[model samples]
Structures are given as C-alpha cells and as structure tokens.
Target: MSRATRRGGTGRSLRTTFSIARPHLRGHGLLIAGGMATLLVEVVLRVLEPWPIKVVVDAVSVSLGADSGATAGLPAATVPLLLACGVLLLGLVGLRAIAQYCSTIAFALVGSRVATALRARVFAHLQSLGLGYHSHAKAGDTVQRVIGDIGRLQEVAVTAGLPLVGNIVTLVVLSVVMLVLDPLLAVVVLLAAGAYLLLSRRGAPRITAAARSTRRSEGDLANTAAETLGAIRVVQAYGLEGQRAEAFDRGNARALSQGVKSRRLAAALERSTDVIVGLALAVVLVAGGWRVIDGAMTPGDLVIFTMYLKIALRPLKDLAKYTGRIARATASGERVAELLEERVDIADRPGTPPLGPVSGDIRFDAVTVDDGHGRRLFDELTLDIAAGETVCLLGPSGAGKSTLAGLLTRTSDPFSGAVRIDGVDVRDATVSSVRGSVTVVLQESVLFAASVRDNIRAGRPDASDADVERAARRALAHDFVTALPRGYDTVLGGRGDTLSGGQRQRIAIARALLRDAPIVVLDEATTGLDPAARAAVAASIAELTRGRTTLSVTHDATSVRDADRIVWLEDGRIVEDGTPRSLLADPGSRVAAWFRESLQEAS
Candidate 1:
C-alpha cells in the first residue's frame, strides 16, 4: 500500500515471486515458445480480419449509387463479391479461434506444472526451517501461504495473464497498421491508451491496498478456525462456543469488506476506460466523415480506420479487468515468497561426513546455551557418560535438563561449546545423521492416524514387518495391538487419541526399540499415566533402553530408582551426582529433599 501504488513498485512483487519460482519453470521452454508462436499467428490473423469487412462495406456503397469503387477484375455480380468477402471473414475468424485455443492450453499447462513444483518445494522448505521459527509460526497462516496463496498465482496466470499477453500484442500491431492507413485517426488510439494509463495510475493504489488487506484478514480467519478446531475439546469443556463464533464472524466480515472494496475499485477503473474509449470513437467518427466527403479518404479506408480503432481500444478493457486480478495475486505471491526465504536453522557444514556408527560414549564439553533472552542455561558446564550407562537427570523446571537431549539430536546447536557423540562433534556431521543415531520418546508421543504396524515401522523405514512385531512384543504392546478390531492394520484417530495413554506409550517404545540407536532418551515419558499404566510402561522402558546409553529425565522417584547414576541440576549446574542409593542415603541430600517436597505437594 505504501509504495506499491507507484509505477515501478507495483510490479516489483510480481517480478520477485516469479523469479523465486523460475527454477520450477524450467524444462517447459518448448511449450512456452510454442504458445508465443501460436499467439503470433493469431495477431496476424486479426490484422487481416478488418480487410474483409472493409471490402463488404465498399461493395455495398458502390451498389447504392455511390462512387464507382475499385471492383477487381470481372466480379460483375455484387452477390458474388459479398459472398466471397463473407467466406474470407469466416475463414480468418475460424483460424484465429484455433490459435487461441492452442495458445491457452499451452500456457495453462506451464502454469499448472510450475505451481505444483513450487508448492512442493515450499512445503519441504517449511519443514527444514528451525524449531525456533516454527515455535512462533501459526499453523493456519502457514497453511494459507503454502496452499491458498500459491493457488492464486496459478489461477491468475491462466485466466488473466495469458489473455493479457495476446491482447497487448494485438494492440501494438493494430496501432501500427492504423498509422499507415491514416496518421491522424491513429492519434485517437494513442490518446485513448494514455488516458487509460492515467486512470490506472490514479486508481491502482486503492486496489492494491484493498487486496493486501483482504489477504491478511483471510490469514487471520484461517488461523482462528485452525486454533479453535485444534482445541475443540477444551473449548467445549469451557462452554465457549459463542465466543469462538463471534471471533470467526469478526474475521469473516473484515475480509468481506476489503474484498468488496477491491472489486469496486477495479470496476470503476474498467467503466472509466469505457468512457475514455467512447469519446475517442466519437471524435474519429466526426473527423473521418468529413475527410471521406472531401475525397481525401475513401469510404473503405474510413471503415478500416474505425475497425482498427475498436481493435486497438480492446486492450484497454483487458488491462482494466486483469489489473485487479493481478494485484490480488501479487499480494498472495509475496506471502509465499516471504516464507520460502526463511533460513534453514540446522544443516550440515561444508565437507562434513554423515554420522556413521558410534560407541555410546557422550560428552558435553564446556557447553553453553543461551535461551535467546540473555540468560544462559549452561555456561561452560561439562558432563560425560561412559558407554552403555544409564543416567537420570532430575531438576525443577527450566534447569536445562531437556536442553541436553535437544543438543544430542541437533535440534539446536549449543551457543558456545560442543556436544560430542564419542569423539565427533554433533555440529560437524549432517543433521539427519546426528538425529538418526539417537532415539527419543517424549512425554507427548506424537503418532499419525495409521495402522499400528505403520506407526511402529516409522522409526526405521526399512524395518521389516517381522522386525516391527518383534519390537512390539519386547515393548509389551503386541497383545493389545492384536486385540484391536483389525489387529495391527486397525487405523487410529488423529494423534492416536483412540488408544489409552499406556497403549500409546508402549507403541512409541516399540518404535524406539525398532530404531535401535546407540543412545536413547526418555523425557518425562510416563508423567500423565495412571499408577497401573505407569508401572506397565515402566517395564517396557527397561527393555527399550537396555545396553544403550540411556537418559531418563523425570521427577518420578519410581521411574529413576534403578538408574546407575542420578544428576540433580539447579541454576544451570549439576548440584548432586551419585547413584540413587548413595544420594538417598544422605538425609540432607538435594535429591532426597526434592523427593520430600514432591510428596508434600502431592498430598
């Protein structure tokens, strides 16, 4: 709205978006060239189209006792001349129609293919963006940019852009032909075009502003809908249906008003073009009539000038119609471009190798992490875990317990120092490689609505069906999975909500076991389960973590009672480190005192 109303600024966004999508437009050069060739054929046909009409009008004037016009050799009958002219007109019109169809089809194909490829590329890029970007991004707004905004570009290209190109060429060719026929009449075409441009310069900014506001409102509408639906259960529990409906109404009304305003602005511009061209046509009619009477211009030549003027003016109508559509599409295109520009937060450095196999030796060497708020979670704190050992981390919230696990998987890089798997720094290897060598079972286990076997095999895509069942048996999940209506093939609900807490956890454990990484992390995995379910899941955790470097982050005394080492953290440093028995043996121990405080809070 600010500068887009200016002559150059209006087109900059459109150019940038197409430039971003240029890579996907490759491999279709032949079709694009073919379309241009076809359009050239149509323009040539249009130039000749008015000639046949001029012949008919002159032939009629001669028959009505007018001046004897040049009736070429031995067409003694007027009927034959008229019939020939009519057939010629039909032939030109028919051929032009065919060219139009082929050209439209060719451009349509390019638009569709480019849109598809760009959509896929943008979607993959979104997934590659860092957790930092996604934490603050709204899922609904992101979806709007990926799907809705991209679709608008394709629609405008086929419906408006293709026709605009052909019309522009027609306008130019016809204008040149008019000048050769009668230079003075041709001035009307130039004058009409200049007037349309003037109106456009004045009106375009209002249209752009309205379209931009509409797109933003729609994004907000989508966000509100997604947020409400995702939390439908909570909304229903709190009896907030009226409040949610009111929010949706507000967004809907805002979008409608802006969309209407854009349409109104565009309509006014188009109608104003009609007035400008109409006045130009009146001037030509009066002036050309006098020239023809004085014999300076033939009646046939005047007819050609009038026909060419109408043809040249047609582009003004096209410009008016397509301008509004293009502005809206430009706004959407800029939204998608902005998302594609997000930096990839985690990636492999140059010349780095993939993380192959490694022993379970882990080290946090002088590691420091800033939470982006000036406060450091870990400032040069170092820790080490020997191969095939179990370490449980206990801390009150915000003590950097989970941050350690995040570092190992390369979910984020340490601010200052390094986290090494064996001897290789995690940052030096490919991100996929670092994450693939470790397995994690988080508190909120996320699963798709797929078969039990599919969910289990997600850990290792190449794992066989037999291997999946074996991992499930070890995790104590096979019995219940087989009891479902369709056994392992039974589809679950969204987020696997159809399963009980214990059942969902066991399936997650099976997936981790199937991964079979050298290091495993369980972060508050059993926090929200009933006592009986917790005990059952606890047993599955044992088998999954066996013979691996295990990290269990929890405050539940029962979950970590068997750990070989317990590290209690406070204020970004390890406050207590010992075996469970050794730490509990001391009554004044931080770990023991924390347990007492937890029991009192529970009571």
Candidate 2:
C-alpha cells in the first residue's frame, strides 16, 4: 500500500459544514472584524445612494411646482439641501469602495491561513493512524481530501460565508429605508421577499443533493486513476489497460451528469428570483404613483422606494451566485469530519512506561491468531529462539509461515497470547521501542523515488555516508550500485525501476543492516532471484545476521540447510523442529519433502 495522504467525507448539507469549519477560523480575529466592518459600510452605502436620487426627484418636482412657500417650492433653501445630498452620496460611495477592498484582502488572508492550518492538522492526524487503517484506504482519495477538498472549502468560506452576512444585512437596511419612505410599498416588497424565500426552501435541498453526488463521483475518479497508475505493471501484465480506462470514463461521466443537474437547478432558481424582483418593482411603482397623485407621498419617495426594493433583492441574488460553493463546502466539511472522527486502532497505552533497548531473545506463548475472517491462522503455536540463534521456518505455500513471522515483529498483535522479546511482553512495552528492536525485510522491497543513498539511509536516518557504503558492501549491493551512472547519488525512479529485483532486495537488506536491530525477520527473502543471485543474497544474509536472533521464512533448501535449526510448519502448526541434519536425514519428514519440492521448482 502507498503512504497515507489525507481522509475526508462527502456530505449533503451546508449549515452542518459551516458549523464544523467554525473552529478553524476562530483564530482569525482581525480578519473577521474587518470583514464585518466592510459589510456594514457596504449596506450603509446601498441605503444612502438612493437618498440622492430622492433628493434630485424632489428638487425637480418642487422647482416645477405651483407652490409658493419656502418648504414647498424651489427656493434658496433647496440649494443647500441638494448640495449636501450630492456631497454625502459621493463620500459614502468612496467609503464603500475602500471597505470593499479591505474586505477582499482580509478574507483572502484568513482563508489561506485557515486552509493551511487544517491541511497540516489533517496530515499530522493521518500519520498517527495504524497500518491496518492505511492498508484499506487509497493514497489518491486521501490526497484529494487534504488538498482539493480543503481548497474547495476555502473558496466557499470566503465567497459564501462573509457575503451571507453582508447580503442579509443589506436586505434589512433596505427594508427599513423603504418602510420609512412609504410603508405600503414596503409591504409589497416584503411580500415578494417572502415568496422568494419560500421558493429557495423548496429547491435548495435538491440542488445540494446533486452537488454532493457530483463531488463524490469526482473523488472516485481520482482514486481510480491513482490505483491504476500505481499498479501499471500488473495492469499491463494482464492486458487491462482498456478495462481501467473504461472504469475511469464511467466515473467521469457520472460526475459530469450530476454537475449538469446542479447547474440546471441553480439556473431555474435565478430566473424565478429575477421574475419576483421585477414583479415587486412594478407593484411598488404603481402604488407609489397613486399615493403621489393623491398628495399622500412625494415623487422623491417613489424613486427612493424603487431603489430600496432593488437593494432588498441583492441578498437573494448573492445567494443565487454562491449556491454551488455552498453545496460543495457542505460535502467537503462532512468528509473531513468523518475522517477526524475515526478511532486509531494502534495508539500509545495510557501510563505505559517507555521501553529502552532490548536483547535478541524471542518467544511466542500460546500464540493463537485469527485472520479476522473466522478462520484460524495459527492455533496454540509456541516457539523460542535464543539470543544469538538463527532459525528458519520451512513450509508449503499455504502453511502460514509468513503470518507467523509477522506475529514475531508485532506488525499485528496475536489474538489470544503473548509475543515476548527478552522476557518482556511486546504489548507491555512502548510501540516505537518494540518496533525499533525488530525489523522485517520482505520479498517486495519498497524504494522511494529518491537518490539511492537516501533510500538506504531510510533505515537509519542519522547514518553517515561512510556507514551507508559499508552496510551496502555487507549486503553485496555496493559493487552494482557503484556501476550506475550517478553511483550512490543516482536518483532511482518509483520502486527503483532502474535496478533489477535482486539489486532492490539487496538495498533493502542493507537498510535493515543499517538499522542494527537485535532481531531480524526475512520473509521469502530471495524467492524470486536466479540461482547465482540467490547464492549471493543468502551469503549476504548469513554475514549480516551473525550474532543476531534471526527468523527467516524460506522454501529454499540452501537457506534452510544453512540455519542452525529448521522448524517445519503445516496448517499453522509446528510439525517438526530440529537441527537441519536431523530433519533432512529423515526422508519421511515433511520439511525434507518441502525443501526437495522447492529445489525442484527452481530447476
């Protein structure tokens, strides 16, 4: 399996996601304050700009009227009022412009900070998860959650969150302005807003659902591509290129179809909102005109009311524009929440004392393990190896030899018994110390896309270059490694494709040697090597495992005969355990038959 990337969920609601994201933004106090201030200023400007229109209308009406009083006609008194209105309108517009600029900058800063912190936190949490959790999850799905999902949320929080507050405030301010100008027309606009809200409530759920499906399909597509690329060799070996491509195409088509559905709902919502706004304007115009003719309302009042009605619909329009982001954010937040809530299977025990260095002696007592599938892996299995003895386990392909090796290193804890190292139960010791004392080198050696020297040093990061070269020499990899164009510094592509399988395994052995652990486990170490290569690797293992407690699982007769003792496992049971000479001398022994078959298969 590839390393952990990130984990998140896909959800279908907006309010839940925003509430979940609140904690991430709680630290950005200055940004929140600035954005709120800008929103307030923008609303104030929306209300003030229309008063000037009212002023111009009143000034024109009075100037052309037949009235004679100072308050009724265009007298010298009207000049100061018109001039003050003009100046106030210009000043508010300038303030609104500055506030809008500040708001944008503040939101961008806050969004970046929040997204960075969340991604880092998620990455760190993933590191704490156990091997079992990682084994079942995909690297691609996790990567999307950490980078793409969180990034989509940043856009949502900035575009949807701040504007949500601003638009609602603008609507309220416009309502108050209209009510003060003419209450009857304000009632008409209010009714129209109620209708808009009702329609939004009716359609919002469907749009949100469609958006969530699209997001999930996109994530599935990402996982499919990642899995196919990682297993490109296997895919090509089986001639499955077309099959993988078809799977990806299916996922992509599903996402596109769902996205189209969401877009259609959003478009319909917008058209309906526009229709309501236009109808409200017509009603208000007719009512206000009648009141003006009856001398109950001024012509200035009618113009101001019309502007207020338009301003009130601004929130609904903002809602329309942000609908898609709100839906996507809801999905991303739910995904993140699900990942954060997962319990880590492997974690530190409470009040457990730290374990220091360990001796090489190993023992398994009543070591019964189940594969979690209601089948026994090993039943009542018990064994022991002295501090410096090398033991080889020989068995057929289905004999649970590899499973027994895994139990020794605590890669998995046995179900019903104890795995002890130097007389201490591995469960009683700290996880890192237990792992540090034992290392396993498997058949498929993993090499990162880094320089050969760095890949070797992964076993012991603090190892010097000289120590690394010495370890490589001991593993029989030094000569071949030096032959490369860049030698030790040569960068290897994924899984070290530039090198042969035997070379990769040798590097892995060198890495294990650098670790200098007292207990070493090798699983089918040279199973895939040629006869000459196997001889070289077997000799290297013998030299490196000197004076260490080594448990080697092999079907190779050469490795078996080289061991101090050979334990024959059959159906997860130890059928025979003795020195190699004694086991091989008995022709009827299962260990002898298994070794003969392995040698024949190699030939």
Candidate 3:
C-alpha cells in the first residue's frame, strides 16, 4: 500500500471537502468586507507617513538655499499644509485602528457561527448514517470530529481565508505606490515576497500532515476515554483502571508530541520568512543610500520607498501565521468530513411503505443470521406464530435467542431468508413502521434521568398521565413509584440506581406496556428480579400478552409454563418444538433437562 493509504488518509481528496464547504464561505461576506476596509485604511496611513519627511526636507532645503522670494514656489500656506498633513495622517491612523478592531470582531463572529453550523450539519448527517458505519468507529472519535475538530476550522475562516484576500490586496496596492516612487526598490520588496511564498508553499503540506496526525491522535485519545468511561463498572470489576489509564495517557502523549512537531514546523517557516524579509530590507537600504548619495533619488523618495517595503512585508508575516492556522483548520475539517461521510448499515429502504398497523402474527422463514464474525447466529430456521399467541424460547447460553429477538425488531438483518410481521417482510417496511409495530424489553432495562412518569411515557410520547399511571399499575410498578418522595414526578438518578434491579425491570415492563405494540419480545426480562418481584412481573407479562404475539426468552419455569408453545434451541438451531406441557413431560428432552437444571440452580 502507498504510504498515504497506509495512514488511512487517502480515501477522499481534500479538495472535495473544500468544494462542499464553498456554500458556507458565503457566511463570511461581512468579515471579508470589514477586512478589506481595514487593509485599505492601514495602507493609506502607511502611504502618508512619508509625506511628513518630504515636508520637513523641502522646508529645510528652502530655508537654507532658495532665493528669498522663492516663497512663490512654496505655498504661503506652508505651516497650514504641515499641520493639515499631520491631522490627515492621524485621522488615517485612527481610521485604521477602528477598522482593524471591527475586522477582528466581524471575522470572529461570522467564523464561529459558520463553524457551528457546519458541525451541526455534519452531526445531523452522521445520525442518518447506518449502524454498520458506527460499529467499527469509536464514539469518542466521532464526538471529537464533531466538536473539537470543527471548532479548529474557525481559525481558518477568520484568519487565513479572509486575511489572505485582504493581505494580497494590500500588498499589491502598496507595491504599486512604491514603484511610482522608485521602481528598483519595489523590485527588491517583490523578490522578498516571492521567496516567502515559495518557502511557505513547500512547508504547507508538512505542517498540514503534522497537524492531521495530531488531530487523529487526539481523536484516538477521546475514543479511549469514552470507551473506558462507558464500561467503568466492568473496568473496575476487572481491576483494569490502571491499564486503561495508561492506554489513555499513551494516546494523549502521542497527540501532544505530534502537536509539538506541527508547532515546530510552523515556527521554522515563520523564522525563515523573517530572515528573508530582513535580508531584503538590508539590500534596499544599501541601494537607496547609494542613490541618495548620487543625487539620483531624493531623501523623501527614499523614505517613501522604505515605508512601502515595510508595509509590503508586514502582510507576508501575517500570511505566514495565517498559513499555519489554515493548515491546522484544513486538517480538522477533513477529520470532521470523514465522520459525516459514513453511511448507516441499517435504514428503511427507499419507497418502502409504512407498516400502518400490524396483527400479532409473526413468521420467520428459513432465516439465517451471521454475527459479523464468521459465526452464524442461527441457520435457516423457520417458525410461525398465530396472532395473539404466547411462545417461549428456551435456549442454552449463546444459543442466539437475543440475536433472534434483535432480528424480530429489525435491530439487525438476516444474512439469508426473511423475518415478517403480519406477513410483511421487515426489510420491505419503513423503520418507523417496524419499530412502532414491534417492541422488545431487554434483559437490562435502560432508564433515562427523568421523572418516573416521563420514563414510562417515553415508549409512547402521546401517552397521557392517566395512561402512564395505568400502565405502571399493570406492570406492578405503581406501588413503589408512588412511595418515592415525589411519586410519579420523582426523578431517577444514575440510570435509576435509586431503585432496586426488580423495580427498574418493572418500570421497563411499564414502558413496554405503554408502547402497545402488536408484537413484544421479552428477553430475560425477569432474570435479575427477586422471587416475589419475579412472580409479580410474570403475572404482569401474562396480563400484557393476552392479545399480542409474545416471544419470551427465559429460564423461569413459571414463564415457560404460561407459553402456548415452547421452542427449545441449542447451538443456533431449534432442537425441539412442542407445547410446554409435552416438552416438560418428556424426561429425555433437552428442554426438560435444561428446565430442571435452571430450577435446581435457582433453588
């Protein structure tokens, strides 16, 4: 592989991202105008600084050697002219200062807004992307691109982009004024500029590369931190805090080192520019002094030439600084674009119809699922559930019950064959439709940091307070919820840690009940509950499953006993299919043996 390709930075050309950002550039109109005004004011003030020298020189020359009446050649308004020039120069300088201040404010305001808008757009796009895209990516890395990297791009918009234009105009205008004074001196300044541009161009890519490396490492660091924090419980339990901390420190150190390298390159480029400018000034001074001694150029013209040279070189210094900032911004922008370009693996197909409403019937036809590892989760399994039927899935650990449940709700897609709800293939239905028609209550209930009522009502946003209370009561969660300090309005903290495991699970059941979907999959929903809570939850499940297609993956005999049909699975295949009564009665059956083992384990 090419070196760039090996670096994982070769897929998209940088220019394409810039092209996409062209529309956003329009946001800087006011900033650009303000910058132009500032440059013009600065050049006009610089151009006037040499006028006082000319006035003093002429005034001295006339007093020393001119004929007494040569006052006719000089304006009788000499004192007035000198005073007026001073006033004008002061006025120009003041205008320059004001314009400079306005430019800074304008550019900063517009640039920050543009950066924020761009980031929002990128984030919105990322959300639309497929799960397959996010699976191999890190959450922290994605957040870094959206937040940190996009923020860096603001410097380019404010400093490099606008100022580059403003400086170029200033340089051209000043160079012309200098040429009108002394062409030879103007040539010297242009030569310095040429050298500076050449050096800056050669250095741009190296600096950009270093900046890109720094940004990428920072993203990796963010990913490490987020990953560690996300699984803090696991990390603590496994005594992995030191190992994770070391990993994060290493990532942070790498980023810091790369940042140092980028800064060093930028500093070198600036120093080179300063050296070249200093050399050019020396050359101009020597040449101008010779011309003055030879009487070829007046001292006033020499003074003007020097002023123009200084003004011309000032922008070059500005450009050097802006160049480095631009490189960093480009690097940041490219990283953000990389994330925004990702596509989601699972999404509603184009032209797919809404599921509208579904009956409880479910069909799995020769369905097979691959776990993205080479292992098959299930192989060509076929099953049918009549409307409002309650079924139990009995499986050994790693027997693919959770995978099957995920497939039912379109959390994933089958590798071959299909899963249908009410005879409609899930893939052919809109995601909203499928999700609305089928809901799953996971083994571990997730509760947001909200009031108890809000948590239960989230499953159906339109649900009223009365409806939420009804659902909670049916789930057997109302009594405890009402006992909380604030009852239904009580806020749950830290994923509802204030409640016991059984309480959280009961709240989840309330949420599922509120959803009112035609099909429900309860996967180990009662696993962590105590005996009393487990029995109460099972009763609620029985009540809720009265008129829905229910698929329960469980080890609880009470839950299994309530199933109309029991499907026993082993090694990703259905090993037995029969009514629960028959399966439990068969002594030789794996389902019966597993049931007995679970009962023994529970006891």
* TM-scores, all models, native as reference: 0.94, 0.88, 0.85
For model 1, how does the per-residue alpha-carbon lDDT over 175-198 read when each residue is reduced to its tens digit? Answer: 889888888988888999999999
| CA deviation > 4 Å runs, candidate 2 | 1-12, 15-23, 64-90, 408-410
Per-residue lDDT over 1-603 for candidate 3, one digit per residue giving the tens place of the 0 to 100 score: 222223323124246446446667685786767756766776566566667766555565555553243222543326777687678667767877776677777767877777777877888778766555667778998898888877777766666776676677778888888888788878998899999879976887788788888888998999999999878889999999999999999998999999999999999998888898899899989998788767666555566677778778878887777766777777776776666555556687779999866887888999998777899878899989898888888877888887787778776789999998888899999878888887778778899999999999998999999999999999888999999999999999867878888888889889989999989999888887889878787777776677899998887776788789999878778889999889889999988898888788878
Per-residue lDDT of candidate 2, residues 1-603 (tens digit): 111112122233554565556678887997778877887877787677787767777777777772433225443327777788889889878988888778877887888888888888878778777656687777787888888888988987777877777778888878887787678778987898899889887877677777767777788889999999999999999999999999999999998999899888888888888888888888888887887777777777777777777778877877876776676677676666556666676556887665666778889888997775678878989999999888998777777788788876566778888988988888888777888888788888889999999999998999999999999999999999999999999999998887888889889889989999999998988888888888788778877788889999876677777788999887868989999999889899987777787678768
For model 1 the local lDDT of residue 112 reads 93
Which is the leading candidate under lDDT?
Answer: 1
| TM-score of decoy 1 | 0.94
- Residue 519's lDDT within candidate 3 is 90
Residue 3 shift from truth in candidate 3, angstroms: 13
Worst 10-residue lDDT window for candidate 2 reads: 1-10
Candidate 1 deviant stretches above 4 angstroms: 1-8, 68-77, 600-603
Of the pair 1 and 3, which is ahead by TM-score?
1
Q: Is candidate 1 or 2 superior in lDDT?
A: 1
lDDT of each: 0.87, 0.80, 0.79
Q: How accurate is candidate 1 locally (lDDT)?
A: 0.87
